[model samples]
Target: MKAALSSVPEKQQQDSEFLREVLEGLGGKRKTLPCKYLYDEVGSRLFEDICEVGDYYLTRTEASIFANNLRDIASEIGRDALLIEPGAGNCEKVEALLAVLESPRGYYPIDISPEILLDAERRIKANLPEMQVWSEVGDFTQPGVWDRLSMIPSRKRVVFFPGSTIGNFEPEKAEELLEMFAANLGTGDGLLIGTDLVKDSVRLERAYHDSEHVTEKFNKNLLSRINSELGADFDLSLFAHRAFYHQLRKRVEMHLVSLKKHSVSIADTRVDFSEGETIHTENSHKYSVSDFNQLLARGGFRPICHWKDSADSYAIHYAQAI
Candidate 1:
């Protein structure tokens, strides 16, 4: 059965917000772009390609952790528990987890894109014939999602947040997001989070700046999206992809550098770029297990236990809401 997608009524606001953010970010002294805008339908497809790129180890590494520790992870989650993945948990990942869950109550996978969420719903239901699934599509942080979650009845609700996506949030926002997850959870509810650990800068840099250049395309797609949607005139050939690891900040930053001086007009707005000027796009933050535990504490969660891969390049942690 196809699960009904709980749509957030934001279709009207999405485009206007995108344009506004693009204008605002571009006008700033240090030119930057919203990272979320990089996941349009086109960009989303490119991201799927990114996951398959050989240098992008985060996906494969986390998969190995789950594959190796599925039983133990399931035991921690307990029986008849409702599993909620806040964002981006695909059908295959959810099905794999559900396979080992002890009489799982249901699964709620929320994402902003209807295209992906609906497809995920079909695939998940196809695989788990009897599983209860509620897929929501929209900004998961909004009140609509909060209500949707609190309304569901279950013995335990565990937010299965994987993929080290939380690493993308700034520390303050990370704590706020965790607190939001904590607020949605009742007593005994859990946050199963995965994070990319701090590692050698060389490996970290290569992960984002892959040899296959898929990451480059992933980064450049933002410009293509802006050009297509906002009526912006950007020559994709004039921009080059740049990514590097910042060891002190423990993050990898992605940017698009202008190869020559230019001005791209977007719906009557002229944004100027100098030769070698860059538009900061995204950052993937890494964390040590202890540092993340401290973050969880601030975010109203108590770390229970964590699972790590053989080399400790990544970690999956289970935390209880305080």
Candidate 2:
């Protein structure tokens, strides 16, 4: 099984940009790294485990809502539209949607990791032999990342952004990304997005800090990845994964706390850690349907239709380019 994979031709520049970002993040006051880096092979597998864990309800709930509302959502998507999914991890939810979507011209599952992206594309093609799969390896947040969509021949385009991944960004940055999506599509094009709604604090917290320890392993894998890729000496056992909901911020914060005072060196960079000091890894902001709609508007999208599961645990919205 083969799939057309598109990646930036400039490998040297890509590496330079990665090292620069890592330096900027580690040297900052908060000491952080982009969550995107966490999707390396091992990290990706750990995340798949997280979605299935008992406490993590987002994935299962979202899939249920999509399944129930598949027909209605397909109506809004219309026929022969090109389906482009950003952060298309494993292409799981999209496969369910493809089962019902009317002859989509093509399916583009874009992700940052090439190995996982191609593997996912192959699986998707195997499942739906007739469907066209074009997977790309690049950061979808970059300004010109959507330029390749223009090369796909289709009158209508639907950007499928499920997994509530938008919550990973600050509201301001989320709006900026939505605006980028708006600029990429023509009038009447759609953005079919899944967002986790604000809910009980305890439930939200548990979803990230799962009892199975899968999320913990997933969080710590970032350090393991850095050590492997950048020649860093990080004793993974020296740090513990910590995640909790910040009531004031209305988001789940993930941190890798130093078990005790320690220091690590990466390439030519030296970073010192204090006992209990943490490197913030990711933030997932929960939202009310109203808050999300306002956010969509700010990004130049108008929510035309939406659906929520029986428990209202999650929502799938269909918005049009304004």
Candidate 3:
């Protein structure tokens, strides 16, 4: 079971530019790293592990929703609608959908990790041999990836974007990306989105700052990645991982805070940080029901159905393109 893997054109160049822009924007203020940089191969695997942890309720909660409500979801979309999943890491949630969905012509899994994407394709094919599987390896935020996806032979397309990945984007960018997705699918095509609902500060903090500190390692791994890929000299030990809920922003901000003043060099680029200085890494924004609905409305999506687990800690929203 072999699968072809090609480097997306100019991926390296795009990555370099992305790093430069992000680092420069931080300026002398708190240095920052983009969340996208956190998914380099190993990081993706660690994230999968994180999802399975007892403290991380987002994945399991959303999975339960799909498990319980998939029949209704499938009925709404009808049979023969194409299933497309963005950031379809490992296809665990997609497998749940496939189990309930009536016979569909094809399944499209889009992701940035070639290795994971191919593995997902192999696993899905083994389980559901009748479904034709196609894979694309590229960032979903990038243009033209959808154009290539348009080649898939299906008239009605329904996109499944689980994992609350939409929370990674700022409100504006989230809306823009949703609009892009809505435009990509034909009329009658819809989106199934998972969103983390607003919750207490303590629980939110614990979710990111786990007792075993795996999330800490996940956060600092970004520096390790920079050291390896960009030829940077980053002492991962000099920094400590910090994650907290920002009540005003309604988000969790993950940072690598310097324990003491340190200087690091990446290639010819030199950066210095003072004691207590931090590098902003990632933000997981929590949304209220009203705020989330407004976002969907702005993105031209009409909320059709929403499913919540017992605690109502998270929500799985099924929306249609308007």
Candidate 4:
């Protein structure tokens, strides 16, 4: 079987990368890990479930904005633009936009998962056979991953990032990423992004710590992944998920706490855990509308138009590289 191949460099690359990141994070003084690791197939599926939960309104609110404003967005983007979406996930958001854009030169959906990318490509190809579907499997955070957008001649480039995923990045890092977008995209190129706005702490807390415990499973899945990929002894039952909004940081932080003092050996490294100790898993930073606009300006983007739900719970901003 293709999966039985024992000598693939890509397979080795993922394992090596996971091992390196785990060791560094576990050894760090803060005992924190990167949120990006939480997207193994199961984690990804859990996230999809989180979106449907009534408490989690980011997806629903943003979807409403798109539904009401897709035509205006498409008009600004114009026709024959190369639509490039980083972290394309299941490509549902891009699909909505594609429906409105007239005669796009190509549809390039980029994601870290090859399986998801292939599925997205198949669906898009089946639905919109007239447009080119060039799906790629790679990390979009890296510098040159987006260089391909320039290759398709005579088409303006448009970068689409939805799902309030930008909240995952710390502010400074977010600015850096937006600047990278500006650098990669040509003059007059547009960037469409969705972001969660700061709101009631209770509602925000409930969104991450959902009633069905799906979010808990999603957070704990990171350890399961580490155990599977690296030879690690992670007794999943000994850890519990916890999420809370940190008002000072304007972010909701998720952690996996140890129920009892324990130790786990990851490869040759043994990491000790004290009772009640935590491994910080993820942070979703909420932003005020004006604060986010300042961030976009710092990233060399000028916000041209935006749409938000009546409650102002979320935002979809269309900005251009300045």
In angstroms, how far off is 210's CA in candidate 3?
0.6
> Model 2's lDDT to the true fold?
0.87
Per-model TM-score versus the true fold: 0.95, 0.95, 0.95, 0.96
Clashing pairs in 2: none
50-131 in candidate 4: lDDT tens per residue?
A: 9999988888889999999889989999988888898888888888788778888887777777777777777887888776
After TM-score superposition, the amount by which residue 224's alpha carbon in candidate 1 deviates from its true location, in angstroms, is 1.6
Clashes of each: 0, 0, 0, 0
Ranking by TM-score: 4, 1, 2, 3
lDDT (Cα, tens digit) per residue for candidate 2, span 198-301: 88889998999999999999999988888877788999999999998888888999999999998899887889989998889999999989999999999999
Q: 57-127, model 3: which lDDT tens digit per residue?
A: 88888888878888888888778878888888888788867867788867788777889987888888889
Worst 10 residues of 1 by lDDT: 1-10
* Ten-residue region with minimum lDDT total, candidate 4: 1-10
- Report the C-alpha lDDT of model 1 over 1-322, residue by residue, as the tens digit: 2334333554447778889999999999999997877776677778878888899999899999999999999999999999988766354566788978999999888776778877787887788888888787766666576577667788999988888889888889899999889888887789999999999999988889999999899898998888887889999999999999988889999999999998999999999999999999998999999999999999999999999999999999999998
Q: Which stretches of candidate 4 lie over 4 Å from their true place?
A: 1-7
lDDT of candidate 3 at residue 73, scale 0 to 100:
82
lDDT of all the models against the reference? Answer: 0.86, 0.87, 0.83, 0.86
Q: Which 10 successive residues of model 2 have the least lDDT summed?
A: 1-10
How far in Å is the alpha carbon of 286 misplaced in model 2? 0.5
